[model samples]
Target: MCGRLALYSDFPSLACSLKLPLIKGELTPRYNVAPGTWISAVRRHDGSGQLSLDTLWWSYRPPWADDKAPQPINATVEKVATSPYFRGAFAHHRCLVPADGWYEWLAVGGRKQPHYLTRRDGEPLWFAGIWTERPDGKPGCAILTEPARGVAKAIHPRMPLILDQQSLEPWLDPELTDRETIRHLVHHLPHHELTHWPVSTRVNKPEEDDPALIEPLEPSAP
Candidate 1:
């Protein structure tokens, strides 16, 4: 599951990559973004075919859901397209979550070890996502995850569903709603372009958001 991530590129840089209009604001470089917080995403929530970079609460619960309903941060590929809690958003509120990279943990010798995963070329990655309006009227989202591939398999059994660059527009195309049609047009970013390395456990603390947290852990460190 993808619970933590980093996005250091500013609005203009992100806009350039997405080819969308500028949002006219700057965002502080975030090296360790955690859940239950606002994060940037590109989406078209209405019939108007406009895409905007907006901050979304990194957890999801539809407006109709019960007050005590759980807020999920990641939606599994196996169920997102079919689950009652997610299918609607998956079909109509799809979005792209930009990230420089993400963090995952592995059980190593009875302890959890964090690892940083990013494109080997160092280009930013885009995570497939779904959004919905919360009961309080705030926009919320959950990242989509699929079975891990390549080196990511060694770190975890699942990873964020990173979208291929060419699939971006098709993914957000409001007119494309059929599950089979959507799946046929959109594709995951190739696993070969991604790589990972062990990092400091400091990332385990939501409060510790800094560049040093992504630094490769020293061999002797526990």
Candidate 2:
């Protein structure tokens, strides 16, 4: 489950990486982005093929849902196509949730040990996501998560689905509906291109959004 993530890069830097036109709205760098806050994402229109960077509320509310149930923040690709709450967006409003890194907690000796995962080169990472806007103007999104691989399995059972440049066009293209293509893209990030390390427990708090939360923790030598 990806409950928290980091986005320390400036908007211009993100725009450069995504190769999108200049953003028209104000943006900010988010180090510890939590659910329910406004976060940046690049989404495309199914019919017009228009892509734009927009701010999406970090929680998902189904069109048929009332105000009581918990807003879903993570959507499983395996079940999204059949789920009542996610089927529409799954087929139509796919998006990319950009992040510099993400945090996951490892259960060690009954205690949660925080870990920060990112590209080894320290560049931005993109998580597959879906979004929707209601008639009243409120919009929300859910990050897609799949089974963990390699070292990530040591941290959690699931990790956000990441896409590289080679797969980005297929992932974002509305014309592409082949599930096999999507699965191939979600296989795993190459080990050499990714890295992870332990971090402080301060990241567990949603209010603790700052640079210090990502400082590496010294691991005891074996």
Q: Which candidate achieves the best TM-score against the true structure?
A: 1
| Candidate 2's TM-score | 0.87
Candidate 1, residues 67-105, lDDT tens digits: the string is 899999999999999999999998899999999999999
Top-scoring candidate (lDDT): 1
- Using Cα atoms with residue i matched to residue i, what is each candidate's TM-score against the true structure? 0.95, 0.87
lDDT of 2 by residue, 1-222 (tens): 888999888777777777655444556777789998888888885566778778899999866677785688999867876787887887677888889999998888888888999898888888989888743467889998888877788888998888776666666767665566666654435556778888888787888888888778866621
Measured with C-alpha atoms, the lDDT of residue 204 in candidate 2 is 79
Worst 10 residues of 2 by lDDT: 182-191
Steric clash pairs (candidate 1): none
lDDT of each: 0.91, 0.79
Name model 1 segments beyond 4 Å from true: 20-26
Question: What global local distance difference test value does model 1 have?
Answer: 0.91
